[model samples]
Target: MSYTYDYPRPAVSADVVVFDSSTDSILLIQRKKDPFAGSWALPGGFMEMDEAADATAIRELKEETGLVVAQVEQIGAYSAVDRDPRGRVVTVAFMAEASTSESIAAADDAADAKWFPVDDLPELAFDHSQIISDCFSKSDKG
Candidate 1:
């Protein structure tokens, strides 16, 4: 018998869940770019060549949210049909626990950024809501 592995080629991206302990809010941004314009989403972007996934996530958090990650860990991977508006995309979600959430803002492709309470979240673009759900579920496990 011959064995083969169909290599999966999906665009890799990272999502940063910046949490604000002061207000108990999570960071979200209004995407200025396509795939989901004028909609709320976590601070994230695609990975560059030779970039590590966790590093990319942190980098994205800094680039998009002006917030440095004090601690970060891999949450999970999300890949589903039509997950992205552009094309098939696979995202490696990473949750960042920042020491201080204050003084954080948005830039780059984010039109506007702000923090919202977890209980009062806005309609999110893509399957980010599900990703957040998964993150909380994982947290509940431990």
Candidate 2:
């Protein structure tokens, strides 16, 4: 059987560098799915067709955190070979920061979602560690 090459590769997604200036901490969710089950990672998910990158970011963020996204800034795009264990996936990383003093719990595929100090990060799944680092570097001086 011949496969259809007309379709573009499926895309993956992730939100990074979420921080609370009050606590100087970054937000992350404990993944409840495979490829890094039980590991803490940035809030994100797969991208759906017809939705803009930022739209996906807002949707995922709200779904995972239960907090309406107040602001979003596009950080960068990462498409490393083998970045995703499932298949070739491109991720658009977005930075979201807003004031929300309330404690957050997980919603979707995340077992739990919480904030951690940026400098004192836990071992994250995938190349998420790198994504977070790049985000920090950009705002490090600002």
Candidate 3:
């Protein structure tokens, strides 16, 4: 059941911000692909046809970082036109808390995975720096 659309549709993706409050750190992954290869970013990917945004966040988190988070709260949607270099892509961001003790390994499209202090993060890919900042700001307010 494929149908052609007259207008172009933007790709939708989901991203997760896993924060460890005790350590004041966040989990990040080094991308393996060319869009931002070797750069650190959140655990995320394009959404699948059948899964919801939250499900995409969880699945991508597990697939890329080998971390299974039980739940997450929505941060918000980011739809900046130039956010993604690949094309017009809008991302729904989610946040969760995880223990720094939890084991994680790089897999799938992630070259590496590790936790970094929120205040001392490496340069990030995409709009991830802004995403992380927004997450913290929201948390601070709420």
Give the best candidate by lDDT.
3
lDDT for model 1: 0.81
Off by over 4 Å in 3: 1-4
Model 1: per-residue Cα lDDT over 7-68, one tens digit each: 95778888877665556677898999887889999888899999988888888887877887
Which candidate comes out best when scored by TM-score?
3
The TM-score that candidate 2 achieves is: 0.88
In what order do the candidates fall by lDDT, top score first? 3, 1, 2
Worst 10 residues of 3 by lDDT: 133-142
User: What's the residue-level lDDT of 40 in candidate 2?
Assistant: 90
- After superposition of all CA atoms, the RMSD between model 3 and the true structure is 1.6
Off by over 4 Å in 2: 1-8
Candidate 1 C-alpha error for residue 108, in Å: 0.6
Q: State the weakest 10-residue window (summed lDDT) of model 1.
A: 96-105
46-72: candidate 3 lDDT, tens digit per residue: 998999999999999999999999888
